[model samples]
Target: MVARTTDTPVGRVKPCRLIGLEQHHDERGSLSIVESEWTTGFPIRRIYYLHNTRTGTARGAHAHRALEQLFVAAHGSFTVKVDDGHRQRAYRLDDPGTGLYVGPMVWRDITDFSDDSVCLVLASEHYDETDYYRDYAAFLEDVRRQP
Candidate 1:
């Protein structure tokens, strides 16, 4: 299991398990599987991958309103910053088997990518333009209004 780190109380971040995918190694090569149905709790509905063509380019300057995400550095390495509108933490993802489960209400930024890095994101919901909060100020206000 991946380690959990939160600046504020642990109650705030609500990180779920970072499950290791099943890997098969053979003379030909290695293969890994990530099954949505096998997921313990979160039901994945969407899957996408982020490949940074530029070496230092960063992505994900916003947070999701209701979607939960699990990010994995399938190849190479990168850093993921997660903030709950109060405290923030950065996690380095270098292992293909490891992933970071980012719950809803957290602002996430993925950056510091090594060359050839590929980020695979598994989301609990399908793409909905209304579910995204692109502005930081608006995100903070929305979090404050939440009971």
Candidate 2:
């Protein structure tokens, strides 16, 4: 199916997919950690989180040039969508122990956030404003130029 970037539920997108982390259980609750280059595939050099997002709002409507990110929902839930020019996918992040790995060249947008949601992001590179493609049309052009 041809994937069109739309706010409506009429597109077919491919999910970057979620990676389930190993959870250690105990009476005190649970613990989990991600190893860089092993489970994460990239060494995390930066960390950030998003919270207090109002309902019906969205975030991350762009793509990175070379940055890779792993997104985890530490609390509540949100829907993440990604487009690769040829295809698109949406992933629902709700489990804290699970992570969504987003690679470069993929246009992404995060929407449908719950009030109590806490989204944690582990990035492979340091912050670089020049690495971001903030325009959707530009992102598509970049993707199309890729082999």
Candidate 3:
């Protein structure tokens, strides 16, 4: 999600938001479509999925400096916690037709995976270790310095 940077007195737009995909259902099954040109604000450069995650285990304890991603629950359920230096929020993902969009500079922590869970990820960029902010304190400090 691309957040609005302007101050609103009430609250600033969050850097992470939920996006719903169009789903078609019938006796045959269900189908959901995601088009990069119309859905994701950024072009899709990579696609991946996480599965067989041990119960009680967690993932994603870092923030990206330039990458943007969308996460979907392709099988079961999990929790995604996001922080933007000043604010924090948690989202539960169980529906395959919905995805959580995480923008740059936002910290993400994924946890509480169910036994059959499969997490799908769509990224705007290729794998780059230099783009990752693995330390939370450093991520916070850097984001706070931004205008």
Candidate 4:
């Protein structure tokens, strides 16, 4: 895995990928499955998909405290903005075979849809409202004070 620079508030971005998952296609359609230990370093505990998004609409305007996520544009195209409280990075995702692994402590927002965009998220944990930092100002201070 390699880290790439993003337009996020954080100055650096770490890229990672898990193995043992494949996209299967046939005349019927397509299917994908994530198995345990598939990701080399990050372990997934939950999986979710977002669909039926309208063009120019945006979603996800919060940051996670402990959960890590891999965001994939399953259908169509969309842009994701990642903020690490110091720097922010933007990613354009349109490929079904690729994904952007976002670590904890980063604020993320998905937008700029191409009319048929669908986002699939692989999470390291289940939903927890307390684990999220929705306020940008607070997030920035938290990252700044982190040792």
Best by lDDT: 3
| Model 1 lDDT tens row, 1-147 | 223366343115465335677788899988877777575247889989988647778999998877888888899888887777777777888888777778878888888888899999999999998999999999999887766
- On residues 1-147, what C-alpha lDDT tens digit does candidate 4 reach at each position? 222374223423343332334679899987765554564246888889888887667899988887888877778878777777667667788877667777788888888878787888888898999999989899888888876
Name the runs in model 1 displaced over 4 angstroms: 1-13, 26-28
Stretches of candidate 4 off by over 4 Å are: 1-33
- Evaluate model 2: give its lDDT: 0.81
- Poorly placed runs, candidate 3 (over 4 Å): 1-14
Q: Tally clashing residue pairs in candidate 3.
A: 0
Ranking by TM-score: 3, 2, 1, 4
Q: In model 1, how large is the Cα lDDT of residue 12?
A: 50
- Give lDDT tens digits, candidate 3, residues 2-89: 2233332111233677899889999999998778847778899999999999988999999898898989999999998888887777
Give the per-residue lDDT of model 2 (tens digit) for 1-147.
Answer: 122344443122323556788789899998877888777788989999999999998999998888888889888998888877777778888887899888887888999899999989999999999999999999888778766
Q: For model 2, name the residue pairs that clash.
A: 13-88, 13-89, 14-88, 14-89
Task: State which candidate has the highest TM-score.
Answer: 3
Q: How close is candidate 1 to the true structure, as a TM-score?
A: 0.83
Quote the positional error of residue 139 for candidate 3 in Å.
Answer: 0.4
TM-score of 4: 0.78
Q: lDDT order of candidates, best first?
A: 3, 2, 1, 4
Q: Could you tell me every candidate's TM-score relative to the true structure?
A: 0.83, 0.87, 0.90, 0.78
RMSD of each: 2.8, 5.0, 4.5, 4.0
Superior candidate under lDDT, 1 versus 3: 3
